[model samples]
Target: MNSLKTVWAIAWRRFSENSAIAAEMNGRFIATVFYCTVLVPFGILSALFMDPLRIKGKPPRWLQREPVPTDMDSARRQG
Candidate 1:
């Protein structure tokens, strides 16, 4: 059908004209982006949620919320 040819042409154009597509057609960039977005976060969250059962060493400290030192006037007030 004529529609098939037109669709193929559009697909070819998409493949050719896009600079990103021109870089890597073997899908490495896409896989890298997907791994960065999905697997890295998943790994981080998994490690955070799971307890270290003393199979190796002490568990690392979790991040704690702390107040910033906004009292810079302490030195001036003292002097």
Candidate 2:
């Protein structure tokens, strides 16, 4: 009877402590799924289709001097 009470007390304390950690782990798991399944793919597709979404910033001096081709043929063909 004494050992059962001790184990129950320990189990309750552990549950209280671990509940918050479990909630945080759950949040991170959800965010990871959101990024992998939705946000990242949408960002990539939108950037590919739209020009404004793609360009990060102004071109460097060398890039400005040497014109970069935008054609599909200019890009490496991988098959």
Candidate 3:
């Protein structure tokens, strides 16, 4: 009875260890596949079509400065 219990305990330990390692490996593989297939392609398509950065032709809005108000413009505004 004691020997049987020992064997069962060892088997349970081995199974738990193997399951933990397998779960880690499968999780990593699934994440990589999702990133490559879904996230990466969506990012590429959005960059190409949506122009989020305004990189196609027009400069980004932050890079453009509003035209400085000239003295004439100030005078006109005052008038």
TM-score of each: 0.34, 0.49, 0.64
- Candidate 3 has a TM-score of 0.64
Leading candidate by lDDT:
3
Q: After superposition, how far is residue 29 of candidate 1 from its true place, in Å?
A: 0.8
Collision count for each candidate, in order: 0, 0, 0
* 11-35 per-residue lDDT for model 1 (tens digits): 9888777966656664887889999
lDDT of 3 by residue, 1-79 (tens): 9999999999999999999999999999999999999999999898768965556886557776688677887878876
Worst 10 residues of 2 by lDDT: 55-64
Model 3 poorest 10 in a row by lDDT? 51-60
The runs of at least 3 residues in candidate 3 whose Cα sits more than 4 Å from the true structure, single-residue gaps closed, are 51-79
Give candidate 1 misplaced runs (Cα > 4 Å). 1-26, 52-79
**Model 2 per-residue lDDT tens digits across residues 1-79:** 9999999999999998899899999999999999999999999998777677445665655533576777888687633
Clashing pairs in 1: none
